[model samples]
Target: MTLQTNDSAPHPNQFALLKQRRFAPFFWTQFSGAANDNLFKFSFTVMVTYQLSVSWLPPALAGLVIGALFILPFLLFSATSGQLTDKFPKTRMIRAVKNLEIAIMLVAAYGFFTTNLTVQIPVLLACVFLMGLHSTLFGPVKFAYLPQVLSDAELTGGNGMVEMGTFVAILLGNIVGGLLVTIPEVGHTAVAIGCVALALIGRWLAQAIPELAATDPQLKINWNPFTETWRNLQLAHGNLVVFRSLLGISWMWFFGAVFLSQFPSFAKEVLHGDEQVATLLLVLFSIGIGTGSLLCEVLSRRHVEIGLVPLGAIGMSVFAVDLYFASRGLPVVPVMGLGAFVAQSAHWRVMADLALLSLFAGLYSVPMYALIQLRSQPTHRARIIAANNILNALFMIGSSVIAGALLSSGFSIPQIFLFTGLANAVVAFYIFLLVPEYLLRFVAWLLSHCVYRFKVTGEQHIPISGPAILACNHVSFVDAVLLMAASPRPIVFLMDHRIFQVPVLGWLFRLAKAIPIAPRAEDPAAYDAAFAAAAKVLQDGDLLGIFPEGGITKDGTLQEFKGGIMKILERAPVPVIPMALTNLWGSYFSRIEQGGAMVRPFRRGMLNRVGLNVGTVVSAAEVQPALLRNRVEELLA
Candidate 1:
């Protein structure tokens, strides 16, 4: 995981803090919340749709009510919750929420054990609404809590870990919920006991969490949830980038809702299987999501990079479509356990498809969540997160409507999956194109880490206008990521030919559209082409980044500045801004490292206090490689 400090620089061991009291308790609480919510809601959904079909109300109507019960809280209570989070101690508030969960579980238990559906039904609905309130209140506090407890370096890694935990909790919860309902005598009791136990444990954990004071303590409690929710929405709406990220995240929920809510029907019609098959699909998807979320840390080296979104979308489309083909002409199978299902010949395709779908879903989601956390302001972070949750709920409701319509319109379950996968691809393309910033950031990130360590300051010195050449000391490969993270504008980097040939790193660079240069003696044509591209990029009023040191530092010191940078500058006459990257000498990506290089970033709070120092912007006429090198060296020293 990418370990960072409060200063937005890397630190080691940020991951370990996840296990500490401050975070772990809240983690378990949230985990339990997701699990319990799914367990009761899914069990209730199953009961209404199948077991309770003979009831007075139509099954579809009953099912709709159940779904509405769960979602109503987000629409009604989230605003109140967000206000509470900002006004009180989050840990204490969380403790109360958990306790409230325990009470709700009692109501649920009484309903489950009783024969009175009339009395039980309304109680269950009330529980749902209260749970929503709990979630709403918890929303702002949950997200806002992180930046308070975690240093900046820990944000991405920490967010990734939280997301990983949540997905895992969800998978386990869904599987356990499904499984518990099957046992006649123990089923209801087991669920009730589980909810109570998990809630109590959650409460205990909340208590263990350290205190986090309100961001705006004197802020008046705005009891008018609707108006305040809109106001909070307006605050989030102010940051268009963050708003887009939120929408992207909301889209993921819509996709997930469609996939998850259809499992029973999918298992029955698509796989021609029983309830167990539906459970299996849930398990696979949940496991896949958990795996994918966790993998983001490994894939991103701890930064919240958006390229993973496209990668995830691609995986989703490929596997989902493949799954449809895999299921073609397959025979239906009866209900079976894991082993039986495995033995049942037709289940293989469904399982494979489910697994891949979940995996891709994970890849698509984790970064979006982390990006919100990373990009949102520390104070209003939770409310923004709450807004995300609210949007997610709304999108999910819409997904159900769309999926139901499709299913009713003669679309097979697998066909729906196929369409959704294709739609995912289209949506991904549209979102990326609409917001090129995500793509640009990915490019910057790729250049920073693949090339060398980057340091920036007086980044403001680089005119936020016109064209500029960012000249910096090349200490390691990842200089681009840091610079990109720091730079407000997209930069077209001029890099060496050899650096563009390494395996996975090479693909990332190519994807970023980096201009690779070879010496006149190495590849003269490629060299000429690279410079031409550099000039064009500058002419387009984009920032052009280059390292004057040529390549990685070989002697633990800066090399004599090369003149190719001077050539690029003379062609553009753009302002030249110098920067120094410090404390990244020992990072795994550092060229100074030998074999057995550990490329993964350390957990937050584990790494050294690394920083990027941005120097003054010099005029093109004043640009001197030696002078720039000396200035950068002085900063490093």
Candidate 2:
């Protein structure tokens, strides 16, 4: 069954989603659940670390144990939850998950009410595991549900809002949990009441979510988690890009989990601050994530721009390294309150580093999540996300263990931050090398948005998925790069062989896997090979781009279309989208009056306006050289 998008409003603001029933109820429901989870967990961790004493559970290990328990269910039950999510209506699953959260919180409230440390600790620990189970069940449903309801255009913005909301919810939960647990007399009671109240609120919000049919209603159940987990990993591995993205996201969790799990001890020992300082760090990190999440929609111009991924990685590493330097040599001071910590000039850099690092983390993650949802098959999308959750859990658990070992080895918290930061650079570089598409897109995005102002009209003509031919007028050498920036999905361009000989741009085209075509009369083998490669791209259900005019025009005028597009259409009967590039004639990449392109740099200056106008799709039968040229000319006019 085909899943349709629920994007009724044209050019709607991301915030407007909060007002619609299709999105709002689900958003708030998940928000409340995140808040409750952190509220209960942080409150318990703070109580154990600062308020209570236990030999079996030391203060140093409190955060790690709590975090490990919460993610444990993701490793064990995520596969089953994902299968169930696919087989059943999402609204039903959401309500059921919310109900489970309510029950778990009630149990936790009872535990919090107990006065005995031994009884209270064990009961609360059990609740943490149960809460993890709740999140595991909801994980697939939360992510998979978005692609069902949002259009491709809205996917990035929608995911951004959710990322921002989740972190903000985390921020509030941590703040409240940290503060309430430190209260003089009613601290425990306050935390208990808050957890139950948030759970109730989440349940109430879940009731308002509209009914959504299951993506794969007939999928058979898989009872064994180990077998199902392996099967789900196989499903994700089927798409290398998606599978790598799953690993990338999991790695991010690994990096973040270390810092998050160390916050209590870092605040107490390193910064010499009270519990409020720990809460303040969370608040800064959460606000940064929220800001960065919102910035993604603005930065990408409301597109699923994966180009931002590399940029985000760079910032995350840079800020993380700076954080190490910022906090490395702080003066030894007495434990301070939030105000005193903020007032200290020496501590400001540390705070900035945390916020900025988390901000970039937000930018790095939202696009990947949107990409996974957009690329994965609709039928088993939940399972793929479940695989992601499983990987995330494993990586986070590894993070806890490694961090614990590092601490045991006498490495200070600042040194761990430095190690993680440097490690991030190596991991990100390796991933980019494995997938050059990311770097290529980054370069294209940089040129399109920075070197030139690019805009696209009738972008809907570009298919979000499946095979199609993009026939555009080749105006300048950078035309393909601009098109890449405009497209949500990758396009395989069949360009003249000479363009592949150009300086830096040649390397970029090669990296983008563009097919280099030659004239059939001059080099038959190369021409045949290029055509064959183009055919394979379309055969594999990917977009094929062609410059039917064969080469860049000498003058600022349209050239006669060549017959290459016709041959491609004959090989693969896909729709040909007519497009035109306007106002790129006098640009730096275009030919000058002397008939040489790229003779002068910045001829048109920065932010020069360039536009791509997409005409209606022409069926394979109706696609001809002259017809396509006429269509392009019409769009150009």
Candidate 3:
């Protein structure tokens, strides 16, 4: 099924989505669910660790056991949940899940009311597992529902708001749970009532979510978790980019999990601060992630800019490594409160590092999520996200194991942070090398955002899916890069073969998989090969970009269209979209009055205003070199 566009907002931003019916109710529903999950789990952990005395579940192992129970459902039920999400109406499933949360919280409230420590311990532990199951079931529906409701233009902002909301909810949940459970006389009762109240609030919000048809209503239910899990992985693996993105996102979870799990010990042992300092670290981290998640829409110009992924990776490594330096060699002192910790200048750097590290983590993750939603097959999108969740659970489990081993082998928490930071650089480099699109987009994003003030008009005209020929008036050497920046999907450009011989840019084009061509008279074989490649691109349902003028404009004016576009159309017969790159003339990459391009740097200085105007598509039957040229000229005008 084709993705639906929400035209509720003429121009949509992250916050603007909060007021829209399509987004707001669902946002609060998921937000309340996350808050309640964290609230219940953190409160239970605190109760067991400090108040309750259980022989089987000791203080040291309380967090570990609770966490294990929480993530266990993802491994056992995520595949089944994904299938169910695709099979049922999303609103129905959302309401059902919220109903389940209410039932589970009621059981938890009874467990909290029990005065017997022995009975209460098992009951709450069971509640932890039940809450994990709640999250597992909701995971697929939460992500899959967005693409069904929001337009491609709103996907980034919507995902940003969701991500920001989720982190903020977690922060609030932890704070509320921690505080409510610490009440002197009625701690348990307050937590019990609070859990039930949040669950009811979530259910109420779920009622307001608009009904959405299932993407794969005819899909048969897969009950066997083991086989279905394998099948789910294979489905995700069908698209290598999507699959690798799943892995990238999982790695991010693993990376962040390590820091989050270490914060308590790191605060107490390394920073010489009390429990309040650990809470302080959590607060800073959550705020940073929320700040970064919100910044994504602004930084990406409201597009699914995966370029930020690499930028985020770099910042994560940098700040993480700096955190080790910031905290190492601190003098041992009596455990200090939050106020004292903040008063010390040395601790300020430590706080900043943690905040910045988590901030970059937010940037690294939101695009990957949006990209997965945008690129995955709508029918199988939920399953692919399920695979991502499974991987995340496994990665988080692996992180715990590895961190435990590292600590047992005498590695300090600061040392572990240093090690993770160094390892992050290697992992990011490897992933980017494997998926060069991330690196390519990073370069294009840098040029468009840093080198120029790039704007796109009529971008909604570009087909979100299917084959189309993008015919543009080529003004400079960097036209393809700017176009790539403007486009949500990758565009395979047909360029002059000689441009392939240009130094650094050549390598970049090759990495981007741009096809090169020569004049038939000069090199018939190369010309034929280029057109063959272009046809294959369209045949595979990808965008093929062509500069109808054949090369860059020499005098910064429109040139007569060439017959190359006609040649490609004759083979693929896809719709041709005329585009115009404006205000790139006289820029550093364009041919100047003196002649050669790129000979002088910063000719137009920084943030030079440039734009790509995408005109409406012309049918294959009506496509002609002259017709396409006139369309581009009109756009240029």
Candidate 2 lDDT, 390-447, residue by residue in tens: 9999998889788879989989999999999999999999988778877878888898
- Per-residue CA lDDT of model 1 for 1-637, tens digit only, reads 1111123334545457566776777777788787777777766666666565446657777767877777888887777787777777787788888888888888888877776778766776677777766666677677778778765445556666677677777777767777787677677778777777877777776777887777767768778878977987887888787888888888888888878888877767766666776777877887788778767766664545665777777788888788778877776555545566678656677688788777878878877776676667666776787788778888988898899899899898888888888888888778887766676565555445444444444444544446878888876666665677666445678888787777766665665677898888988898888888998888887788898888877645888999887778767777777888887766666654353334555622253455778777677889898888888888788
Clashing pairs in 3: none
- Rank the models by TM-score, top first: 3, 2, 1
- All candidates' TM-scores? 0.74, 0.95, 0.97
RMSD in order of candidates: 9.2, 2.3, 1.9
**Candidate 2: where is the Cα deviation over 4 Å?**
1-9, 408-410
Which ten contiguous residues of candidate 2 have the minimum total lDDT? 1-10
lDDT of each: 0.73, 0.89, 0.91
On the 0 to 100 scale, the lDDT of residue 430 in model 2 is 91
Top TM-score: which candidate number? 3
Better of 1 and 2 by TM-score: 2
Q: Rank the models by lDDT, top first.
A: 3, 2, 1
Scanning candidate 1 in windows of ten residues, the lowest lDDT window is 1-10
**Which regions of candidate 3 are displaced past 4 Å?**
1-9
- lDDT (tens digit, per residue) of candidate 3 on 477-506: 888998888888899999999899988899
